[model samples]
Target chain A: MIASARSWVDIYLTEMRIAIQQQLQYRVANYFYMIGMIAEPVIYLVVWTTVAEQQGGAVGGLDSGELAAYYIVWTLVRNMNIVFTPFGWENRIREGTFSGELLRPMHPIHYDLGYFAGWKVVVILLWLPLAAVLSLLFHPTATITPLGVVTFAIAIWGAYLIRSLNQSSLGMVTFWTTRVGPVFDIYFTAELLLSGRLVPMSLMPDWVQQIAWLLPFQWTFGFPIEALVGGLSPEQLLGGLAMQALWIAIGAVVLRRMFSIAVRRYSAVGG
Target chain B: MRAISLFLTFLRVGALNELQYRANLAIQLLESGISVFTGLVVLALVFSQVPALNGWSQPELLAVLGVYTLVGGVIGMLIQPNMERLITDVRQGTLDYILTKPDDSQVLVSVREIRIWRVVDVILGFVIIGVALVQLQGTLGPLDAVAFVVALLLGSAMVYCFWLLLTTAAFWIVRMDEIVELFMGLYASGRWPVTIYPDWLRFGLTFLVPVAFAVTIPAEALTGRLTPELLAGAAAFALALLLVTRWFWRVGLRRYAGASA
Candidate 1:
């Protein structure tokens, strides 16, 4: 079992290398894409800063500079947590490219994982310079306690797993549906609302905040963001981690069932 | 007169091509419906927190949202689909076929692709704007109504030129799609009042991206807040951009033909 695990890791790393190399060839477009990614967060940061100032230098326990830090961290975490699974899988399914993936010895999830790893490396490298520029411009203030740092580390990893599994499961639904663009659009709309991408959850209505807490969207983005900037109790950190694991398990089960059914349907349809 | 007739003919052909996919109309309706709902709900949530956002009341903001939906629908219905196809055509060398056409290549390329279903968003926008006007107890005088129409036309012209210029960049840059996506990212911020944003961002939306002129300025007319200077500025900007984009389009065509030959 250990030897098999090692081999799987080696294969994943190799796949990641190829994906990275392919992405590197489009370096110019990739830089522009990075700028596009930062634009949304910057817009939100400026608006929230304005809101904070209007409310006399703070909104929901966060000052303007703290809000800046929160968004900067939010930007980093969002970039890290992003998984391009749904559209890629749906396109593959529609174009009959999934057959090639199915013919491979490993599960298709491995390729997605490798692709995500490669993309994350690119994002991280791109993020450093952009984040540095934003920091120089905005002067975001962050006070990271040791405990907060540790929790943030765990939360970021948990957030990534949750996002990957959730998106992959959504992608697997392409077997049953012809058009997944609407589904992806709706999912993005939900994330924008509930994941604290547009605004901090505390600033949102009470009902929205309550709804966000129950869903995996908050765990994937908002919770980690809040934990990073605002101090979280150990118990709350543990609860957040537990919630993340629960959602991850749910996503995994859904993905496995959906993949199995999709494969059966594919064989039946002879595609 | 001849160009007008030719443009209408191409539009008819485009309409017929879109009619073949009737299901896409339903998809477009569903997508636009969700988008409008999300926008209204976010607005509702925001107004619930603050009674007035940057001195604009709820109804006023709803009018802005309506304008945003209408302009967005118009673009999706005509401009975006064509420009998107233009990019793909340029990349694949199929734009040569367009260049060979007897009619104006730019007109043909610009009007070739239409998603007819996007009219639903435009209709929905007008309905919402009407409802918001009633809610606000605002009377639309003939002059105000005319001003609104003029602003809408000017806004549409500006957006089309902006899209044309951006797509023309494909002549120089191989992957201009990222730039288009950046426009989309920037455009999403137009849902809120530009006054709420900082000056730099406001400038970006107004002059750089032209979202403010597209959505906000028209809604401002409806709400009786649009200054004459702003309207005139929007008109002048639209005209200038139209001319500039036309020139750029010609230059891009020349470059494309030169490179291919």
Candidate 2:
């Protein structure tokens, strides 16, 4: 068991190294993608900041400073939310590349996790200079407690895992139908609204907040941002992680079940 | 006269090709519906917190959104698909076939591909504007209506020029998928009036990308915020951009050595 566990570690490490090297070579392309993504939260920040200043310096209990912090931290969480998407799955199946992935000894999810985790290192590094510029422009303020920092570090990885698992399940749908754009659109729109990608959960209508609380969307986006900037208490911080683990468990089961079902339907000959 | 006929011919062919996929209309409807709903939700959320953003009321902002959707629909339906194909052709060296055609290359490349179902957005944008007008008490004057149309046309031209400039970057850059992302991101800022952004950002949206002209000026026309001076400036800038884009495309074309060579 010890030997097997060690081998798994080695596999993850080597795959991650491959990912880091491959991604670094495409720095300009990756930065272009990241810059495009940064536009989203920046737009949200500007709108809310405008509203807050107009409303005598507060909106939904968040001042412009706090809103700035919420959205600045938002950039990092959004980066973490990037994962192998259903579109990738569509390409793999259409090109008959999934057959190669299936022939591998380990589950393909391990490769995705290791690879994207490595990509996150590059994304985070690229994110720092962008974050500094945003801070200089937006004047974001945050009181980062030690516990909050620790929780944020862990929760971002948790956020990454939960999103990857969930999206992998969504990718499985591609095996059944190639024309899944509408389905993916619906999934993304839901995540955009419910996941605090659009605004802080507090700014949402009460019923929307209640719904987000039950769903896994907030765990991947809202919880991490709030853990850092919202100054959540110890219990709330740890509890969010616990909820993330639960969702991760559910997502893994759904994905594994989906993989089995999808593989049975996936009869594409190798490329 | 020839250019008009050329565009109509390609338009008909593109429409007929897409019409075969009857289900895409439904898919487009679903996606457009979701998008419009999301836009309204965001508007509602913003207005609920404050009566107006900056100086504009809820209805005024809705008009801005309508213009944004309308402009985006027009681009997606016509401009975007053609530009994207141009980029792909440049990369694959198939643009040689386009160059060999008798028609003007610029006009030919601009009108080649159309996604017909995006008319859904174009129509919805008008409906949203209609609704916003209903909520506002004042009637749109005859002059305002004419100005709106002029501004809308000018805005579209500016956006087309901007896209041509960006797509022309493919002559050097090669992989232009990221340009689409960059455009989409910057274009999204038009949902709010460019005036709401900081001066630096607003400047970028105006001169750097021309999204301000695309979505905002027509919106300003409807909302009674457009000054003649602004319209004049937009027209002058657009004219300059057209001349520059024409020159730039020609220069880029000179650099293009097709696959045969």
Candidate 3:
């Protein structure tokens, strides 16, 4: 088992290296894409900072600097949790590429997970410079306590798993529907509203906040940002971690079942 | 006269192709409705926290939303689909067919694809604007209504010219989807007043992309904030861009044909 695990790790690293090199060839375009991502968060930060300043130095417990901190952390957490798996699955299903994957020795999910991890590593590295620029401009104010740091580390992994599994499941549904583009659109809209990407979940309406807390969206982005910047209580941090674990387990089970069903359906259709 | 006939021919073809998938109309409406609902909800959430956004009250913002939906619909219906098709044709060497046509190739390429379902967005935009007007308890007089229509026409012209210029660049650069994505990113900012953005972003929207004229100017007209200078400026810019893009399209076509030959 240990030897097999070592081999898998080696394979993953090799894939990561190849992906990184492939991305490096388009380094200029990737730089602009990173700029675009960073621009959205910065735009919101400036807007909220202006609002907070206009409201006499605080809006929803966030001063201008605090708002900056929140948004910068929000940008990092969002980058960390970014899952390119949905597009992968969607394109593969559309182009009948999944049949080729099914013929491979390994489960398709393993290759997808590896690809996701590889792409994320590249994204995070690309984001580092932008994050630094934002930090210099905004002077984000956040205390990274030891506990908060540890929770953030764990939360990053948990967020990745939840996001990857959930989006993959959505992608798997393409086996049944041709118009799954709308499904992805709805998913994106929901995430924009609920994931604290557009605004802080705490600042949204009471009902929206309540709904956001019940779903995995907040755990994917909001909780980690809050924990890193606002410093969550021990109980809250533990609870968030627990919820993230729960969602990951649920997502894993759903993904497994959906994959099996989709494969069966694909085979039945002679794909 | 020739352009009109060509446009009509393209329209007929587009309609016939789209009519075959009648169910798509319902699906398109559903997708557009969900998008409009999300826009309203986001506006509602933002305004719930603050009564006004940059001197524009909720009703005024709603008018802005209406303008956004309308302009987005116009782009989706005609400009985006054609530009996308133009890009694919350029890539696949099929734009030669358009070039060989008896009429102007640019005109043919620009009107070849139409998404008929996007009329829903335009209709919904009018409905939302009407609702916002009722909420404000304000009457749009003849002059204001005419100004609004004029601004809307100018905005549409400006957007079309801008799209033409962008797609023309695809003749030289193969991967122009990034440019489209950049436009979408900037277009989202049109949901609010341009004045709300910082000076740099405001300039980028106005001069760089002209999204300011596309959505905000028409909303300004509806909200009785239209200035004569801004109106004249939009008209002049639109006409200028239309001429410039025509020239640019010709230049691009020459380059494309030269490269292929």
Best prediction by TM-score: 2
Mark the 10 consecutive residues where model 1 chain A has the least summed lDDT. A262-271
What lDDT tens digits, residue by residue, belong to model 1 across residues B1-261? 776777688678878988899888777877888899888877776665567767788999899889988988898888998888888888777787888878888788887777778899999999989989999997888878888999999988888888888889888776667766666777777777788776777888888788888888888889998888888988889889988988999998877843352
Ranked candidates (lDDT, high to low): 2, 1, 3
* DockQ winner between candidates 2 and 3: 2
In model 3, which regions exceed 4 Å deviation? A35-39, A85-90, A132-139, A146-154, A233-239, A267-271, B254-261
Tell me the tens digit of each residue's lDDT in model 3 across B140-196.
989999999999889888888887887888777765655566566667777777888
lDDT of 2 at B240: 98
Best candidate, DockQ: 2
Give fnat of each prediction, in order.
Answer: 0.44, 0.67, 0.11
The sequence of per-residue lDDT tens digits that candidate 1 reaches over residues A166-195 is 898888778887687887888889988999
Give me the displacement of residue B101 in model 3, in angstroms.
3.0
Model 3, A89-197: lDDT tens digits are 7677777767788888777776666776777777778778877887887788876788998998789878988998898888888777656666787888898889888
Q: Estimate, for each residue in B82-187, the C-alpha lDDT of model 2 and write its tens digit.
A: 9999999998899999899987899999999999999999999999999999998778998889889999999999999999998998888777777778788888
Clashes of 2: 0
Screening candidate 1 with a backbone cut-off below 3 angstroms (N, C-alpha, C), the clashing residue pairs are: none
lDDT of 2 by residue, A143-249 (tens): 88999999999999999999999999999999998889899999999999999999899999899999999999999999999999898999999999999999999
In order of appearance, the predictions have TM-scores of 0.93, 0.96, 0.91
Model 2 chain A, TM-score vs. native: 0.98
